[model samples]
Target: MSTAYVLVEQNNGQLDHVTAELITAARVLGEVTAVVVGEPGTGQGLAAELGALGASVVVAAESPSVTGRLVLPEVDALHILAAHNPGPIVLSANLGGNEIAGRLAARLASGVLCDVVGINADRTADQSIFGDTIQVSAAVGGASPIYTLRAGAVAGEPVAAAGTLQTLELPAATAKDVTVVSATPAERGDRPELPQAKVVIAGGRGVGSAENFKTVLEPLADVLGAAVGATRDAVDLGYYPGEYQIGQTGVTVSPDVYIGFGISGAIQHTSGMQTAKKVIVVNNDEDAPIFDIADLGVVGDLFDVAPALLEEINKRK
Candidate 1:
């Protein structure tokens, strides 16, 4: 039987949503072998969650020095886990997990695929292209296949399982000379963050002003159950939160539908959102760069148009 390794993410022992999805994705391939790498707080429920969802084994790396701050130390134990279980490794596509996935691929001399939405029973990825307009199933090449699963892209089904939980202590990680300091998470809006949004509505300089964004842009997003995003210009002008910017320097998103409200399409901005399945642009300038990639274009005053659009959406629902 093929064995799939699912890396469980923990934040002070709280299980991440991605963990459940990874377990669900593994079910399509074969039996799951879950692994957790970090400090042993009394509350890491990832292992039990994996077990409940049919993980055949759970390997935890507990070392005095192997803190969750770095990937090299975690990669060390991961190599050992893969050797014993020997199969594709799956992880979340978040910053920390993405880094580890890349590092592990380099160390193992393996093929790595990132931001996967789905998986097949034969251990292939259901990859997307052209802004999620196409779905293609692909397998990893090289010695071993490694994949990073994106959050909110996959749905999971739970299955009961009995599994072995092994705790392995490793050599203390060499503390990176980097100084430790207090960490504080950035404050985000109650509105869904862009990465986790199903539909994203973005604004640009075309929207007119920063004040207009809340009155016109935000209400529409709320109607559609969507998150708000912005082009680089919009972010710079304080029309949208910096975290809400989508581009090369910003987060990559693959939402079901992306509605560009008055955003003049910069190639950099399009590069980030081009992965969205359906793109709709609204700009008064008919020749705005955004229209070139837009599946639907509306040339009009957004102040007049957005209210009507929100009304239409609410009526449909």
Candidate 2:
């Protein structure tokens, strides 16, 4: 039986959604063992959830140094786990996960498949490339293949398991030349995170300015309870932070409903959000490219349309 190592990420002392997804994907290949890296005991309470999701074992590596050392310690811990269990290594396809997968593959001298959206029964990976213009299948040639899966790309299913917990020990990780002195968290907001939100409201150059975004977009979003996104043009103009930018160069999102205002629908921008289940575009120009993919298109100014829309929505409520 094959054994897969699934990297589990936790936030604010709870297991992130990606962990369950990875577990669900791993079960298709073989038995799953989750590798948790964080403050010691981070995996203790996660056993039941992980087990219920098909993770047979939870290998928790507690290290206060994980925060200070960056990705090196994670590579080391994964390296140790991979040595004992020779199979596929699965991780989220985020920035840090890509880096860690690359380094770990190099350390283990194995080939890697990245940005994987699906895994076949034979273990080959399915990936979307060329600004998501192409869907390709690839297989890594080696004893073990490392994969970085795109977040929200796969649905997680709950499977019964023993839910056993285990601890892994390694030599104290020595802080490398790169030391993180301090870290500040992003300000908290009530809106759902962009990648995970089922509904997203994005603005582009048409929103006019950052101030106007607050005046027009925020209220609509508040009424709909949607996460806010911005186009590359808007982000480059400093109307919003780079993190909120949704395009090929930024984060990819596959929400249930994506609403765009003043967005022209550049290929770079569409690549990231084309997977959304439903797209509604509000633009002044009838010839805008965004209308090509939008399920519903409005040829009017969002400033005029948004306020009325908000009022109507609130009136019904």
For model 2, the superposed segments whose C-alpha errors exceed 4 Å read: 175-177
Q: What is the C-alpha RMSD of each candidate to the true structure, in Å?
A: 4.3, 1.6
Q: Candidate 1: where are CA atoms >4 Å away?
A: 42-44, 51-54, 63-68, 114-143, 150-164, 175-179, 219-225, 236-238, 247-258, 264-281, 286-297, 307-317
Cα lDDT tens digits for candidate 2, 1-317: 78888988887468887887788887888888888887777778787888888888888877766667677767877899887778888999888899999998888889999889888768899998887889999998777789998877787787888778988874575535368889897795898888888899999998989998899998899889899999999999988889988988787788999999999999889988988999999999999999999999999989889999999999999
Candidate 1 vs. true structure, TM-score: 0.74
Q: What is the model-wide C-alpha lDDT for candidate 2?
A: 0.86
In order of appearance, the predictions have TM-scores of 0.74, 0.95
Q: List the residue pairs that clash in candidate 2.
A: none
Tens digits of per-residue lDDT for model 1, 191-252 = 77687678998988878777888899999998888898888898898777787888755666
Best by lDDT: 2
